[model samples]
Target: MNDTFTEADLAPDPQEKRDRLLAVADRVAALVAVLAGGVYIGGMIALGAGAAPIVFSMLPRSIAGDVMGAIFARFDAVALGAALAVLAAEVTRMVAARRRGRTILSRLRRSCTLFMAVCAAYVALSLSPRINDLHRQGVQRDDTPQGQVLEAVHKRAELFGKIGMGMAFGLVVLSVFTIQPRRAEDEEDDDEAAAPLPPGPRDD
Candidate 1:
């Protein structure tokens, strides 16, 4: 019997090829989302930690207030962009999984992504400007009812930013867990495909 093998014989099935392509795309998207989340969190940390010393020690109060405002505005812009990118990637992954009839995708991840995006938008568009305005007012009028209001706004914005960063980190952790299972499943499938079938008993 001829036992010659051709490239056609070794070629992957079309559906399997497509599935693998989609799996790779999903993995790439997840990685991007994680990276963006990291950027978002890192920027928040820098805004809180690095900017403070510069604002307080290196500059006068008026200049410091303006500098801090500009710094926060820029940080918010970058963080908002990163959050939106992560949200888009996560939504695309969810839609692709649903289209592929995959039941392994976690709904919690989607919820977290949505929440993070909303929080980021709110902070960037609304809270950031309000906080800057209050900072200016506090610098101008430090011992009045308006100053008390400034303190309140400061506390609220700080809490919201903290919550948003926490959500971003949570999404990263969830993505890691979700993708790990898929990686293991892919490896197991590859191993099974490579394993040889046992020989059947020969007929006499």
Candidate 2:
């Protein structure tokens, strides 16, 4: 008995498979980054758009502070988790890309993602605690000089949080664009390949 297999019958090349998997992973990272950005932007907007102030004014100040603080804590928790996931995914993609042949764009993207992740971590862990401490002290005795200083510090931290969040949002947008398939390049290649054959010499 004789057996024969054609090219289509053979398994895909291992390297080709690896390349496809890496591409899929990169796409997933891009998607996660975009979704995480949306979540973060929404939470930031809710906090910055006077939602806390409105709620505080409607209730006893103490109760308002506690509730708002709890809400912010929950937001921070979610933000931190999401940021970690994004960072891990981005790092994985960067390493994979470098193994192949790192481009300038890939390096820039990795740096941007790392900076965004660090910003998110700092905001959640360090800045949040400082803001909370300052707010608590200010609210306890805001008429006093110490309380006034506390209030100023809280405001400054809040400003920093806004700037950090804005940067993170921008970086996420850039990453999304960076990971998108180069459709224009692909189209150009196709057009070149499909160009009409030059007119053949007419038969005598």
Candidate 3:
């Protein structure tokens, strides 16, 4: 084997690894934020539309009821999963941020947290009336009250969705700053951690 040596091959560079990892983390964080924002917006828009969602009837045995029931059962899970993703993405981004200075990410995190709360409220409000209806022995079938509650939920969903979009855009703004040349302290530590070794001989 030929004898050739370079600083890159000699030792494990922690800072380089950190830098690379940070870059990857930044990209992934941004992607997650964008997706979360889109989902939030879409969900909100649907909530705002006040349209009854239709599902294909599989069987004639109360097909509409079955589909509606299924949708209700699954809806919360879907929203919960989306909110969880945003929360997870925020946590991951926080971990990925290497150096000092809190930026728009903090605001984004707050926005995401609020968004999750809004989703939770939506789920809770949607179910409360149903639960109450079931509890009453001979309650009338009027769903006006339920509709009112649902409307309120829809409003929150739409508002939070817009807020999430703003926060996600803010994250993008902060990330742009991070990509620039780091401060001297940031540079100093990494550079000192892995100083160049003056001309060394190969000893494999």
Candidate 4:
């Protein structure tokens, strides 16, 4: 090797490469969760003005027949159930991890759990009013510019729901790597901690 050649140019260790890959995977999984949250929130805000409920709290019986009601109502509850299911899954993951004495990263991905919860909440909240509106006011209600914008919003909410699910799944898969197996040293520690207090209640 000549002075022109540098140590930095040497090949990287295989373990180091694997570590880098895992780090990148963790980061990417978190980013996906963030994006999923953004899409859901943006969609609800955009669509609530125009479409009303896009996926929950209401069921659309028809669309073109009632024109405004028919078209807008179609969006009321299509994806609502799926959104709720996702939320439930997230909540279960979080609660279960704590009770099991494990960190979220140990078996469940926290980023994914958070993304699911937020997205689910957004969908549920967004749909509740529209469901109420549809029942209170028939589909024939007047269509405003707000209604027009909301049409897009509902659609975006639906898209985000799918994306959120995908992100959550990816993060869950990644958590396998974060789950550390119990080592002999850990077993020894547990044994040491479990040794009974020396019948000190009477003496102390």
Candidate 5:
């Protein structure tokens, strides 16, 4: 009996190895996107619904504003980071899916992801700083000009926050309902490949 291993036998198939790596990367990207999105959504809900009301009820308006402002300021960094993570993960997943000849996310999913990132950037980069500056300047009275300006800016910020939260919720829903299961997708591809082609015109 001959005991010999050829170079071809010793080496793994490059295509197979590449597919395996791509599969692993795809899973990782999906997991990262989900985790990051969850953190972003949970944080938004907590700050908006749970923390703000409680803090305002317990503390004076001015003090509560300051406290909430500070909390939001800290969370801005987190929100921005989480948003970036989600965007990166989704882009990675998109690339992986394209390589595999699969559709991982729909157009709506991509749009929502982009919108979420934009909203986070706007809040963190534009709105948060303005709010913080107003807080620092100290709005003495709600009726005064400075106070009114602060109120307007604060209201606008809240509006965007609420919009962002809604977008996040919609994204979660779309992800759950729209994304096809990998197994189902694979089976679909198999079915198509297995399907018989229409009979060619009979040769004379």
Candidate 6:
């Protein structure tokens, strides 16, 4: 019995394995980015279209504002988390794309994801705190100066939320279109083409 290993057998296998792993990672990252963006968009819609009206209609204005304010504060945390997840997933996909020798990082996609993150962070860190402070100060009425200021700030927050949701939706769409996994056979074919042919049997 003879045991021998050729360079051809060992050299190509590691690179092929690496390509396959990166492809799988890319797909997972794309899926995660899309799902996270969807969650953020859905939460915003549910809060604005469903919860706000019902809560305000059922409870007194002041109490409704308080309840909704609390919910919004909690959801700000959720939005920030979703944004971070999307950004992380996008970064992973970019790395995989670079490794695969493809340009999967579209500028529009990056811009949209970044815009979403910025809007979420702005609302969560900057605007939400102001709104919460106003709520705590019992400024629910819309007629007085402080109440008017609260209303203005609340409107601004709503505007930012809408913008963030729009960006999130756009990011999801761009990700679906841009970030795709290469077929396994395609990677294998590429690897085979790049690899050196096995040494032909010598004839004397």
Best by TM-score: 6
- Provide the global lDDT of candidate 2 against the true structure: 0.69
Better structure of 1 and 4 per TM-score? 1
Error of 1 at 173 (Å): 0.9
Candidate 5 stretches with Cα past 4 Å from truth are: 1-12, 99-105, 174-204
Instruction: Show the lowest summed lDDT stretch of 10 residues, model 5.
Output: 97-106
Angstrom error of the Cα, residue 187, model 1: value is: 4.3
**TM-score computed on alpha carbons, candidate 3:** 0.52
Model 1 per-residue lDDT tens digits across residues 19-103: 6777776787789889988998888888887877777688887677678777888888887898889988887677656554344
Return whichever of 4 and 5 wins on lDDT.
5
Clashing pairs in 3: none
Best by lDDT: 6
Q: Which pairs, if any, clash in model 5? A: none
Give the per-residue Cα lDDT of candidate 6 at 95. Answer: 83
lDDT of each: 0.76, 0.69, 0.53, 0.48, 0.76, 0.86
What is the model-wide C-alpha lDDT for candidate 5? 0.76
How good is model 1 by TM-score? Answer: 0.78
Q: What does the lDDT read for residue 104 in candidate 3?
A: 59
Positional deviation of 199 in candidate 5, in angstroms?
39
Model 5 error, position 35 (Å): 0.9
Give RMSD to native, each candidate.
Answer: 4.5, 5.5, 8.8, 15.3, 7.9, 5.6
How far out, in Å, is residue 30 in model 3?
A: 2.1
Q: Residue 87, candidate 1: how far off, in angstroms?
A: 0.8
Residue 18, model 6: Cα distance from true site in angstroms:
1.9
Clash counts for all predictions:
0, 0, 0, 11, 0, 0
lDDT of 5 at 50: 98
Q: How do the residues 9-54 of candidate 3 rate in per-residue lDDT, one tens digit apiece?
A: 8564798677667767766775775576566546545643432343
lDDT of 3: 0.53
